[model samples]
Target: MAKKRSGPSGKRGSYAKGVAKREEILTRALDVIAREGYRGASVKEIADAVGLSQAGLLHYFASKEELFTEVLRKRDEADLAFSGFEAVPASADVRDIREGYLSVIRHNAEVPGLVQLFAQLSVDAADPEHPAHRFFIDRGALLRSVFADALARRFAEGGVAPRVPPETLARIFQAVTDGLQLQWMLEPDLDMAATIDVLFELVFTHARAASDDPPDGRAVREGGAA
Candidate 1:
């Protein structure tokens, strides 16, 4: 007798199933990297967890370098949804501002491995020929643009003269966040969220002081979803 054929329920291309498997493997891959470090983690290890052959893992990610970049990218996109991901939106209420920032701080506070991963990859990417060099640099530049645009819009809406140009502030914000993340990895107990809160408070306070007057500053609102 022949083995029974399975129904479409066992198929791989279904939207829900594919997404679930993708997330599952991606998450496992991230863990492997965190535990083993970049050079230590391998596709075989990831495949073992997923019950897939090494070749099967490669089907999902062509190479280790590709997997590494993609894992980081996925992590960042997810992290953005956490607390402390604030942008200086023109019409944002306190909730949006708080969530935006808290998202950043919260991620910094936890996931020391991710912080380490970013630092290692970034430094390694310094050589012009390094595969990830351009990707990392471009990502940094893009983040700076986000900061600048947000601050510019806020300044316009509030009728406030920004103490520093938006571009300058954006660069500084990313620099400080990256620096703090590096440090926090070494010292996991560091209150990253509080530090970031202080950073925001200082920036906002300076902006308010620069005006030499106070306006109806929006109250911060919490925006991170569970």
Candidate 2:
């Protein structure tokens, strides 16, 4: 038998390189989409934004749909950044929640355009024929479940309280974030971070009263109310 070519590593390297270039193109392309609606965004347009000729951009991305799909996925992976948030004990003080909330607000500011893009594309991803349709739907469901679990864990100790059942509160959590993002997108001049801070303030105070928990650790230090 003729010797079989053993070139798996070469194929793997090629795949990795292709993926890297695709991501680079999509990373730049998202900004283009954010500024220009999907109708206005074409391969040539994105290529121009990144200083690439239309042909060169097309060589890496075969179609506008492919480019947009990759951009949406990259945006999700970037924004699904809630690490260390769940680590705060169910009994964590108000200060922990306050700090974690601040971190989330800071990250949103860092990617204002990307956040706006998601708020727009979310509707597009609902159609079954849309490339990212199923992915977005499934992701939304998973996120809701995960957040609900976190709320449940937090309240399980009886030291924490939620105005409604964790399941209902979970839906409220998603709705509030979505509505805020939409409003902020419409009016970038709005102080989204400050508004978020106020919302949390009200929520925490109510939870404290219902759970009969002590004031936050930092509140004790700064003479602030939880």
Candidate 3:
């Protein structure tokens, strides 16, 4: 009668299974929350959707807030993975990054549920006590930083100065993206990608025109013409 062997392999197997179950729960939870919202989806409902009892779900996640926090984290991770930035060359400039954003927006259109989830959670997270408050705050800051850096790079590449500061431009860009997302949610027919492109064009054109102007309000003389 050999002694029971609970070796490293056994532990690894258990860990892998736990990881798989956790991901399954997160996936099902997203679907449930997308359909029912955070307040409407009870612990039991989420558990049942993942083929677990409420108590079993609690073993993996302490509470509904905890579960929802993990879900939001996973959602952001998924979005970053699909953002196409990783495929961009190291030599890529601001315009390249800006173009990448259009692909992300297009992808978001295909997942209205995820977009709705983000919109709803972002609103709910406005409360200081909410679990997702910090997430959204940090997310906004990160977006502003990335956009500012990209815009600055673009301006540098073209030897053009922006009419507005890069940070200010970044905020405006972020606001437009968020506002458009909300509008698109309400009016599904809205062309969010095209609208964002128009915004980029307007901002870039203004910056470029400003860069081309004479600082002393002097007009450029044409060749052999007044």
Candidate 4:
């Protein structure tokens, strides 16, 4: 019989394996970085945790910056999943989204090392040539867009009203969240989530007031919709 060719299936299997290993490395890296601050989580340390040599780890990523950028990307995906943004309801209530956002902030408090890493990388990524510069730029715009879009929906459908424009409010929220991370790092006792909640209340006072009104009022505003 003629020799059989493994062909595309072989290539696909190898690609799948490579992807799985990369994910494993990222997951382990998150644990290592969460336990050990960015300064402590050296390349060799991450390599050792993943049972790979420095060379092997480096082979997977073009550079350390690329690896860290991927780490932040993974963190974002995990955060979205945790915050219920991955599967938000078609008509999600503002209160529901607010709680989801607060939950993510609360989760961040438990991962101080990651926050430290993020703070450091954010500063470093300010350089346009840095590997993470694009990531941060794109991430910021996307986050602001998502928040703005969600608020716009609420304003139109949920009868919520805010003094500021949705886009501006989104930018303010992002700024506050990022600034709070730095403050929380300096003062561990800072209640970042609660502070954000208070900010939300102050900015969206009308939203809260509307939600609090009797069912009759909400029904009229929402046209008896959920």
Clashes of 3: 0
The predicted structure with the larger lDDT, 1 or 4, is 4
Q: Could you give candidate 3's per-residue lDDT for residues 42-130 as a string of tens digits?
A: 88898889878899987887666667777888876776767777676656555777777887888777767667767777887889887
Q: Candidate 2: TM-score?
A: 0.66
On lDDT, who's better, 1 or 2?
A: 1
lDDT of 4 at 60: 88
Error of 3 at 51 (Å): 1.4
Identify the runs in model 3 with alpha carbons over 4 angstroms from their true place: 1-20, 31-43, 89-91, 214-226
Candidate 4 lDDT over 1-226, as tens digits, reads: 1125533567786687667778888998999999998889999999999889998988888898999989989999999998988788756645557888999999999998899989988998999988889999889888777777777777777565544467777777888999999999999999999999997786566555654455443333221112
Task: Return whichever of 2 and 3 wins on TM-score.
Answer: 3
Q: Report the candidate with higher TM-score, 1 versus 4.
A: 4
Provide the TM-score for each candidate, comma-separated: 0.70, 0.66, 0.77, 0.83
lDDT of 1 by residue, 1-226 (tens): 1124433565553655556667778888777766776556667887887788888776766566666677788777666655345334455433246457666667555555566677877787887766567778778887766666666666766677865676776666777777887777778777877787777677676666656655357633332112
Q: What's the number of clashes in each of the models?
A: 18, 0, 0, 0
User: Which pairs, if any, clash in model 2?
Assistant: none
Please, what is the whole-model Cα lDDT of each candidate in the order they appear?
A: 0.67, 0.64, 0.76, 0.82
Best by lDDT: 4
User: If both were scored by TM-score, which would come out higher, candidate 1 or candidate 3?
Assistant: 3
Off by over 4 Å in 4: 1-10, 158-163, 206-226
CA lDDT for candidate 2: 0.64
